[model samples]
Target: MTRRVYFDHSATTPVHPEVVEEMCRFLKDNFGNPTSLHYFGQKARKAVEEAREKVAAAIGANPAEIVFTSGGTEADNMAIHGVAYTNRNRGNHIITSAVEHHAVLNTVKALGKQGFTVTILPVDQYGMVSVEDVAAAITDKTILITIMHANNEVGTIMPIAEIGRLARERGILFHTDAVQSFGKIPVNVDELNVDLLTISGHKIYGPKGIGALYIRKGTRWRQTLFHGGAQERLRRAGTENTPGIIGLGKAAELAMANMEQEAAYLTRLRDRLIREVTEKISHVRLTGHPTKRLPNHASFCFEFIEGESMLLSLDLQGIAASSGSACTSGSLEPSHVLLAMGIPHEVAHGSIRITLGRDNTEEDIDYFLEVMPPIVERLRAMSPLDQETEFALSDRCNGCRVSHTCRV
Candidate 1:
């Protein structure tokens, strides 16, 4: 059997062994509701609080500020909708970037339908949202400024700290969907100056179906989305996902401990992959910012071929990767992130994202480099556009302008 290599860590990572072990303990022995009033319940409650502390400490936030949710999507929805409704009287305007995850973009669009004004700020060619544009978009009516910490597709890091500081000065609540940046980058809520932040467990080698939202203490936000028995201090309702939360806490602790080393390793592999792919392949262009992107990510666009075709070819060679954001893969449209960065639809259709993980090594990267070039060449040869270009070039001889059959 061919060994398969996974380069889709940005979509989701495998749960760490430590995280799985920690979760198993909770599932088997401590199977009590945190809300129940008994010894078992107390034990479960203790675990839940400890997990909250771990998550909060990971981001330099207060334990009380972390509210658990289903995943990044729910976390984003909670923050945007929670603040939108809670502070509707203060203002009904929200500001965000065009390259944000659909979690934030769709939620804001839903709010627009409900009569809330929304400003979708554009990004630069490198998929970077300018702090100046964000500053200009703010208004007295802008109640929330929710931008992502980093773009999931191109992996371009945003200017969250600058935007956060601006939001603070203007008295507008700032939120960041940091699902892709939390474990992969140094994300301190205090450093970013954000009032609200979102994180997902699976993105950091924890279990899926569990995530958290950081609502700064005394922030004017409310639990307007979920309505049920008090949980997450009434910020999110329903029984706690005890096992998933425990796994997330364990994962958070592990991430904090190994972040520096893991980032360096991934960065080396990521840059090598980018260097080799762009240098060896013709008509290939790196997609995101050259140096201001994620340490574990390298994305690119190959002319004269479709991303799906290259992905299929790579899959046949036991290499797994992604064309763009996994959430929007079902759509036939090109990536909104790429398009927002001024990438033409034709170019965006051929984009691919390679995100590394803790388990990736130099050998894995070398294997990818070995298999990827031929796949791109194969796809390009099969492309109708490439065929047309080839015929056109053959017809127009370089040596002589008059002769149509000058083979040079």
Candidate 2:
């Protein structure tokens, strides 16, 4: 059997064994509704609170500030839309980056339809957004600024701390989609100066369908998508996914214990892959900030070939990689994140993202490096519209006809 190698950690990670063990115990032995007032309910409630505390400690936030949600998308939607609706009287303007995840971008777009004004700031060639641009976009009516902690597709880490400081000075609320950076990088809400942050469990090797949002104390917000009996401080309304929450807590604990070692290992593997691809492939361009990016993320674009083709070829070789965000994969359109970074349409369509994780090894990377060049070459040859040759198709046809003078 062919060995399957997964390089799409940015999309989601497999639940760790410890997380699964913790969750199974809660699911089977500790089954009870957290909202129930009976003994069974009390046991479940204790589990939820313990999980909450674990999540809070992971990010240096208080347990009271963490509001559990179904996942990162829900958390992001709640933070962005909640802020917009609740603070409408203060302002109708919201600022964000062009490269945010669809969760943030789509929510802001929906807000725009309902009389809210949105300003989308652009990034540079290296995929880094300028704090100055964010500051300049702010107005008296600007109620909130939402930027991603790190770009999902390109792995660019935004200067959230700098932007947070600016937002705080202006009394504008700040939120970040930290799904990509939270477990991979060390994050402290106080250190970043952010008003709110979003995290997804599956992205951090926890179970899917569980996530959390950190809302700073004193930030008043209305719940836009819930109806229940005062659970989650009335901010979020739903029966807690006790098993999933327990898994998340275990995952968070494990991450905190081994964050440094995991980072160092993944960084070494990521750098080696980058070096291998760049050296072996011609006309390939690396995306994102060279150094200030995720330890596990390595993104690049091979000019003149469609990203989808490259991804499929890798998949055939038993390697799973991504052409863009997992959310936008099946669509024909190029990645909005790549377009926002000012990459040309053709180049953006040629982009590929390879994210590493704890499960990867040096041998896996070496095997990928060995197989990648031939795949790129084969795809480039098969492409009818390759731009490598300077002459037009007609010019090349003329030469072919001359070489085979009377063949026809």
TM-score of each: 0.94, 0.94
Task: Score candidate 1 by TM-score against the native.
Answer: 0.94
lDDT digits (tens) for residues 1-408 of candidate 2: 777999999999999999998899888988999999999989999999999999999999999999999999999999998999999999999999889999999999999999999999988866788999998998999999999999999898999999999999999999999999988899899999999999999999999999999999999578887777688999988788899888888888888898999999999999888887877776676788778899999998776689989988999889999987899899898888777766667767888999999999999998999889999999888876646444222311221211222110
* Candidate 2 wrong stretches, greater than 4 Å: 389-408
Clashing pairs in 2: none
Q: Can you write out model 1's per-residue Cα lDDT over 64-159, one digit (the tens) per residue?
A: 999999999999999999899999999899999899889999999999999999999988778888889988998889999999998899888988
Give the Cα lDDT of each candidate: 0.88, 0.87
- Candidate 1's C-alpha lDDT? 0.88
CA displacement after TM-score superposition, residue 96 of candidate 2 (Å): 0.3
The predictions' CA RMSDs to the true structure, in order, are 5.3, 6.2
TM-score of decoy 2: 0.94
Q: Ten-residue segment with the worst summed lDDT in candidate 2?
A: 399-408
Model 2 accuracy (lDDT, Cα): 0.87
